[model samples]
Target chain A: MQAGTQKSVLIIDDEEDFAHTLAERLSLRNLAVQVACSGAEGLAFMEQNLPDALLLDMRMPAMSGIEVLRTVRQKYGMLPVLIITGHCSQEDHDRAQELGVQGYHSKPLDFKELFEQLVEVLHQK
Target chain B: MTDKHFMAKNLASSTHELQNILAIIKESSCLVEDVLQINGKPRMKHGDKLYHSLEVIGEQVDRAKVLLRALNSFAHAVSDGAQTCDLVETGKQTAQLVERFVRLKEHALQVVVENGSAHIACPPEEVIEALHSLIIQAITACTPKAPVLLRLGAQQNGQALAIIEVAGAAWNPEEMEQLAAKAGGSVVLAPGVCTVQFPCAASL
Candidate 1:
C-alpha cells in the first residue's frame, strides 16, 4: 500500500463488461480504478490522469494493445504494464517480453493471481 | 496448409470470442462472491449455498476452458500440411473430441503408449480423422462394457504404430487403405484389431 492515498490503476480493454467489472472489484480494495474501452481512449485518459499502473488488453481494432504499449513505453518508460489477452500468439508474447512488460495473462483469468501481481507491481513504484 | 484453413480460422476466431465471454462471466461471478464476503464472511441466509454454487460455476468454467482449448488446438492442425506430432497426445486429443459421443453409447476410450513415445510425420488432421473413424467403428463392434483402446508405440524397425483394438472386431483392414494412405500409413486387420502403422524414418 502507498503512504496515504489509494493507488490508482488504469485498465485499457475494449471489452466493456470485463474492464468495468474488474475495475469495480479493484475499487473495493480502496484503489481508484478507471476504464478505457479502446486503445485511443486509454491513451487520451493517460494524458491527464496517469494512473500508478496499467492493465492492458492485447487485442483491439484500429490501435492494438501493443501499439498502445509502444506509445506508453516511449512516453512513460518505467510505468508498470501488465498484459491481459484473450488469445495471443507466440510472436506477440515474445514481442511483449522484449518490450519488458511487467506481466502477461490469458483470459478467464485467475483474479487472485492477477490481484497479487498487481499489488506487487504497485509496491515497486 | 489444407483446404480447411478457412474453417479452422473461423473456429479459432470463435474460440477467442467465446474465451472473452467466459472471462467476463468468471469476473462477474467473482464480483458477486466478493460482495457476499464483505464482512469477511458470506450472507446470513444463503451465503453458504451461494458459495457452493459459485464453486460449481468455477469448476464448469474450467471444464469448458479445456474443451475450448482442445477445439482451438484441433483448429491449429491446419497450420501446416505436414508436420511431426506426438502420436500419444494426438490420440488423447481425439478421445477428448469424441468424449460425449462415447459416453452416450456407454463406451470407454483409453490411450495407451507402449515402450516409448511414438512420433509420426503427416498431416495431423488426417491422422485424427483416421483415428476418429476407427474409434467409431471400434465403438460399434466392441462389447457394451468393453473399452476402445488407442495404442501407440514404435515398430521394431524404428517405425511408428498406432492401433485401436475392438472386441469382436470384423472390419477388413483393406477397407481403410485409401483413408490410411491419406496419412502415409497402413492398416493391419486381425480378429479384433485395426492398426494404423507408419514409417517413422520417412517423411512425405
Candidate 2:
C-alpha cells in the first residue's frame, strides 16, 4: 500500500451520506474507496476484496464496528483499521485501542487530519 | 433534625439542583448555537456561492433562534418545577425544533399524530429535548432525499411515545438497532421501514 498507488479502502458506516461523502473524498485523494452501509456488509465486502485499509464506524446496527474489527483481525491478522465514530465514548476508545486499531477519528470528521492519518497508515502498510 | 438545620439543608439542596439545571440548559444552548453557526457558514470560497451559502445559513440561524427560544422557555418551565404540563404539546414543539435538520437535509418529514391531546405528568423540557435528539438522529440516519416518517402518539398502555420511521433504500436494521441501543431505546425493522420508538417514561 502506497500513496498515489491504486490502493483500496473499505468504509463501514451506517450514515450513508457521510460514508459516501468520505468515500468520494478518499477517491479524490487517489485511493480506491468502497463503502458498505453496515458492519455486516463491510465484512462481506472485505471477504471479497480484502482492502488495504478499513475505515470503520464504531456504532452500527446488527454488527458493531468493534465486532467488525474483531472479525477482521481474526481473519486478516494485523489489517489497518481507522475507527470513526460520532459519539466517541471512553469505553469505545479504550476498546478500540485495546484491539490495536491503527487510527481513530471522531465525527464530524476533519478531512485534513483524516487524510494525513490515512497517508501515514498507507505508508506503514 | 431541628427546624433551622432542616431549612438550611433544604436551601442547600434546592440551590444545588437549580445550579445543575442551569448548567444543563447552558450546555444544550451552546450546542444548539454551535450547530447553527457551523451550518450557517459559507460552503465555498467563491463570491456568489459564498454569499448564497451565507444567506441560507442566516435563514437557518434565524430558525434556530426561534427553536432556541422555545427550548429556553421549556427549560424555564421545567426549572420552575411546574407540576402539570401538556406532554403532547411539548413533544410537538420538540419535533419542530429538530424539523430544521430534516428540512436542511431535504428529507420529507411526515408527522402523524395519532392521539389528539394526551397529557402526561413529567418534565416537559427534558422529554422534549430527548425526543428532539432522537428525531435528529433518525433524520441523520436516512439518505438525504429519503422520507422520514415520524409518528407521535400514545402507546396502548397510555404511555406517550414518539416513533421515528425511515425507509431508505439502504436502511440497515442492525445499524439502526445499535444506534437505538446507544440512545437508550430499541429499533425494529419491517419490510418497508425501520422504526425507533422512544417512550416518554424512558425519557423521564
- Relative to the real complex, the DockQ score for model 2 comes to 0.01
DockQ of each: 0.65, 0.01
Residue range B58-171, candidate 2, lDDT tens digits:
455445444544544455455445544455566667766777787887886777787775555555655565566556666665566778776766565445556666654344
Off by over 4 Å in 2: A1-4, B1-204
Per-residue lDDT, model 2, residue B113, is 82
The list of candidate 1 runs beyond 4 A from truth reads A1-7, A49-52, A120-125, B1-3, B40-48, B76-92, B108-121, B147-172, B175-178, B185-204
- Model 1, residue B2: what's the lDDT? 43
DockQ of 1: 0.65
Candidate 2 chain B, run of 10 with poorest lDDT: B19-28
Docking class of 1: medium
Chain A: TM-score in each model: 0.95, 0.94
- Fnat across every predicted model, in order: 0.77, 0.00
The positional error of residue B65 in candidate 2, measured at the CA in angstroms, is 17
What lDDT score goes with residue A6 in model 1? 87
| Per-residue accuracy of model 1 over B115-181 as CA lDDT, tens digit each | 4667778666777887777777667756776777778774646567888786876685655776778
